[model samples]
Target: MKFLFLICAAQGRPTATPVDNGTVVGTLGPVDDDVEVWVKEYDEGSAEDSGRRLAGDRLTGHTETVRVRGGEVLVTDGPFLESKEYIAGFDLIEAPSLDVAREIASKHPMAHYTGIEIRPLPE
Candidate 1:
């Protein structure tokens, strides 16, 4: 099984730079001594609705605890980041092709709202 990470970068603010390739799990940065990062396990056919339901649920569960510095708290529905390049959310795609991965990503809940960058884990 491979793991994929969907990271959000700071919008011209003091924040960690998004790493392109590395271990699936690691601390990207810290806030109040707490490391900020996300992790997900991926296998074939993992980006479909069934997979998304589980993954989305997991991410949503942690929404309250995840903090962004200088991040706006939305009173109404809004995009995840204030920056154009910042990631709003991610899906763990098990497909072998980039087109397939991107297609899966394009249908994600966050895709309609913010940008989603789909990159494979470095072997």
Candidate 2:
């Protein structure tokens, strides 16, 4: 089975202080062979700046959102939701079962200060 671990943190909270990579890496046990991890830095400045960064260009901040209602298109800016949390990164992992996936997620270094959501992928 495969699962995705969504790493999240509070919206306004600055990124956690850096920890020794070796210390973080040591927690995975043998499951390291079955997982691929990606880390993302928290977005700073304006939303337009984030959009520009996402586009690999130089600009201000703002993320565009488009919606269709009554055959009319609506465009908006900023995040998709107004919440206290944002996703910081993710891990895609293969495990023998959900139990194994949960165990793997619980061992992630970020699990100590951030939220980790484990979700199964469909076949």
Candidate 3:
């Protein structure tokens, strides 16, 4: 089994313009719904380590922003959307099977409707 973890560092490019147009002007495709384990932020040390690892484990230094495919819509200074549904990032961990994923997701830090979706990876 394989998994894809999507970490939303920052919102992607904004689709809407400043002209107060009623409609957004960018593309927002469907995200991988079968995501497991969501969190506001990871451990500080792990965060730093992940950043370092992203730069090929180079400790020299690198930028501090991560982008996602459909991240731009929900972030803004003002309330652009009606619902408060927002996503930070997701973890797609693959255990031996779905039951294992369920067990892992059940112990998530933020439990409840924040149920992690466990599914087979697309070919």
**Candidate 3 structure lDDT:** 0.34
Clash totals for all candidate models: 0, 8, 0
* Candidate 2 pairs with clashing backbones: 46-61, 47-61, 47-62, 48-60, 48-61, 48-62, 49-60, 49-61
Consecutive 10-residue window with the lowest summed lDDT within model 1? 32-41
Superposition TM-score, candidate 3 onto the true structure:
0.33
**C-alpha RMSD between model 2 and the true structure:** 13.1
Backbone steric clashes in candidate 1, count: 0
lDDT of 2: 0.50
Q: Considering every candidate listed, which one attains the maximal TM-score?
A: 2
TM-score of 2: 0.53
Please identify model 2 stretches exceeding 4 Å from their true place.
12-64, 80-82
Candidate 1 local lDDT, 8-119, one digit each (tens): 4334434332441221222232331221122232222344433321243223322333445578643534455445454434445455556655655554433332345656
Residue-level lDDT of model 2, residues 43-107, one tens digit each, is 12123212101211112335678999999999987767677765655656666678766665565
lDDT of 3 by residue, 1-123 (tens): 534332222244333333324333122321212121133222111332231111111021122434455656333244243433333435555445555545545544322223234455664
Which 10 consecutive positions of candidate 2 have the poorest summed lDDT? 49-58
Better candidate number, 1 or 3, judged by TM-score: 1
TM-scores, in order shown? 0.35, 0.53, 0.33
RMSD of each: 15.8, 13.1, 16.4
